[model samples]
Target: MDANSPTSQYASLAAHCASAFALPVARALPEQPAAVTAPWCLTVLAADIETAQLEQLAAFVSADQWRPVALDILAARADCKVVRIQLEGDIAFAAARLALLELGQSLGVELVLQAGETQRAPKLACFDMDSTLIQAEVIDELAKIAGVGDQVAEITLSAMRGELDFQQSFRKRMGLLKGFTEASLAEIAPRIPIMPGAQRLLLALRALGCKSAILSGGFTYFANYLRDNHLAVDFVHANQLEFDGGALTGNVIDPIVDGARKALLLQEIAKALDLSLDQVIAVGDGANDLPMLSLGALGIAFHAKPKVRAEAPQAIDGFGLDAALYLFGLNDRAIAALLDERT
Candidate 1:
């Protein structure tokens, strides 16, 4: 095909995106370029930014040779500021992203860098329910109710930090909850604080016709509760906590949804949805979440631990879940419009 032909043009675009983002060239290219055109995106967030901070950001951008094509405010909240910048020229997206990270650190702000099929949102977004979607860990809460909080919490922390096997720690923790009444779960479920910005994230994803799933090592009851009542997520894959006569049996159903299982479930969901793995996004904050995170085209460590943040391809520690929308190329205005339509 001629260099200017449609095929060649698409190939060139794909090559540029791959080179910029450090993604595999073949995997970076979408099946239909008309539907998904990649673009560079920079999102700046913080609890607050001063005039000095803004001037610093501007100076940094101007000094860089990338030469942004457009700059717009995506959202400006009392505690946060999201900016969308489109760039021109042969830019190294990864290097620019690193520079932004350094800048954000210096300013005590959060900067997120995303470059890929900006026009195409992930078909499915899989989340780790406990810490990522909600503010508490169900197991630890259950342990607290059962008067084994300290013991179970130690194990839970070890498991999450990758010091112990998840399955083993899970069983040990469940053992501590033995004899607790199922009614305790009902009480705790309602009280589990949903993560800030979760509702908005789900709302934006719904508007984009993207399905959501909860792939958690937590119990089915809480996952289903969030999916049905809180987030309206499409699917949930979690371990079933076995109960007898409305009391905890200290056992879970076979085939615990460990890290490996989480990855497999992501693939299964993608296959079932008729989408590629590249069309999936996974978010989590623990060691067990690494498998699923690594499998997705876009994997984020959300408010994660040092280990997870170090390993995950992307990390969103300083911001809330709504920042994930920026990765999909949704600006503040677009999100506001979507929220208005829903209201």
Candidate 2:
């Protein structure tokens, strides 16, 4: 084949892939393109990109057949940047993206890559309630007020870290709160702090015509409260805490919402909305959230544990939930404009 033939162009990309990623060239180039339908975006959060770092990134992109299309400053506060790139020839999309992610990580930068359509806005955004949409874990707060904070918190930690099964953890924790009154839940529910940026993110999603839902391992009482009072969410799916005589029954309703349920709920919601999985986004902060996170088009770990952070496709460690907007290619000015239209 001619060196400059169409096959040669792809061969060049494949050769670069082999040298850069240590992956077989044949495997890198798929028969059909990866499901990246939109232009690729590389978002940098948490800190400014030094001139040297930007140069490095530019050189990396130039090495392949991808061309840098545009650069937008997403946030001035953190000096966040979002670079859009377009492929100039047939290349392995996933492998190239993985290489970019590794490059950003090496620079201590939080990076997120999204399909082009992701910038158009998601159709549905699902969130894990505890430690995600809110500042505290609802069950842990209940346990604290019930005077079993230490024991329940330990179990909660283990479960979040993937050390224990979530169902067993929930049962054990509920048992510890067996005698707590329903009134205690009311008090705690009203006091649970709304996570910073929760309102902003929800409001932005609403303005974009996105339906939001809370798929939580937490109880329905708190999820409903948040949906009604704080977030502009359209749906809620969570485990119901059973009650007897205005006191805790120490048992959750049958068919608890565990990790598997969370993923299934994401699928159901997507289907109900007439949207594809790629049009959905899921955010969480624990091991149980893994399933739902992996199910969505974009899964983000928000201030997550080490294991979750390492495994989640994307993560927000030093920023608020609102930082998620950047992953969808929204800039600070665009978000501010979206918020201002409220009047």
Candidate 3:
């Protein structure tokens, strides 16, 4: 192949080495032209590839299969060759470079190549209102009036950590609020500080025609508060606390909204909106948020507890709730354009 030809360009790219890379080769000479679904095809070779090496190539954490390939020295299998790749985008040159690096670092291995790209879109944004979109937990604050703030907060922490089940844990905490008044909600609702950049993020999604919801394990009182304020959510599914004679009735309404319920609500809302599971993004910071997170297309563990972060595919450790927008590829100018539309 001439150096100026497409095959030559891909061959040159594949020859360049790094820890892991993908190279694109010219399409085969055939009677019919097939569609190039992925921008680049990668030839991966790693007799020994480590987790860190995979992360450096993929820009995300590596799962376990590639570890041994990075660590051991093995003969390149011609007949039983396999490809273990963590794809980024479909840039042929980029993939080629990544694949070359992997091959260069390994002693013996050669795998086939195919090019592809992933298009991720969130149709539904499911959120936990308390401590996720907003900074406060409604029931925890109310516990202070009943003089069980410390105990209630401890249980809240435990429940959020996945140590306790949501309904059971919430009931244990709510029992401490037997004499609390609904009036406290009025005071606390206004004081609930919205998470930084939360409003802008949601507004951006709404502007983009994305459906959103608050599938909270919290109560309807504050869920309504979010709706009445700036959330602009399409649906809200939450627990309802029963009251009597202007005082706490010490009993929750029937069908408590718990973890399993949260998952069901996410599916229900997605179905109602005619969106598939791959179009839903579930964001939360607690253990109870796991079910819905597991079910969505991209489950963001936003400033979540350590356990939640470990299990979630994506996490926002450096930024605010608004950072979640980055996973959607939105930027400052895009957000400003969105903000203007909402007005």
Cα error of candidate 3 at position 44, Å: 24
| Better-scoring candidate (lDDT), 2 or 3 | 2
Candidates ranked, most accurate by lDDT first: 1, 2, 3
Model 1 CA lDDT for position 151: 97
How high is the lDDT of residue 165 in model 2? 88
RMSD of 1: 10.4
Cα lDDT of all candidates, in order? 0.74, 0.74, 0.60
In the range 1-343, model 1's lDDT, one tens digit per residue, is 6854434543544443333333334322222222223265555666554556656765676677555544444444445555445555565755765677667778887766666454357889999998999998888787877889999988867875678898889888888888989888888888999998898898889988999999999889999998878896999999998889999999878799999999999999999999898889999998889999987768889999867866776778877898887677665556767677531
1-343: candidate 2 lDDT, tens digit per residue: 7754434544544443334333233422232222334356556664444545555665676787666444444443423333233233444645755676677778666766655666657889999999999998888777777789999989977875678888988888988989788887787787889998899999999998999999999989999999888889999999998889999888878688998999999999999889999899999998889899887778888989877876777778777898898777565557777888421
Tens digit of per-residue lDDT, candidate 3, span 221-282: 88888888878788888888778887778787868887788899899888888888878888
Candidate 2 overall Cα lDDT vs. reference? Answer: 0.74
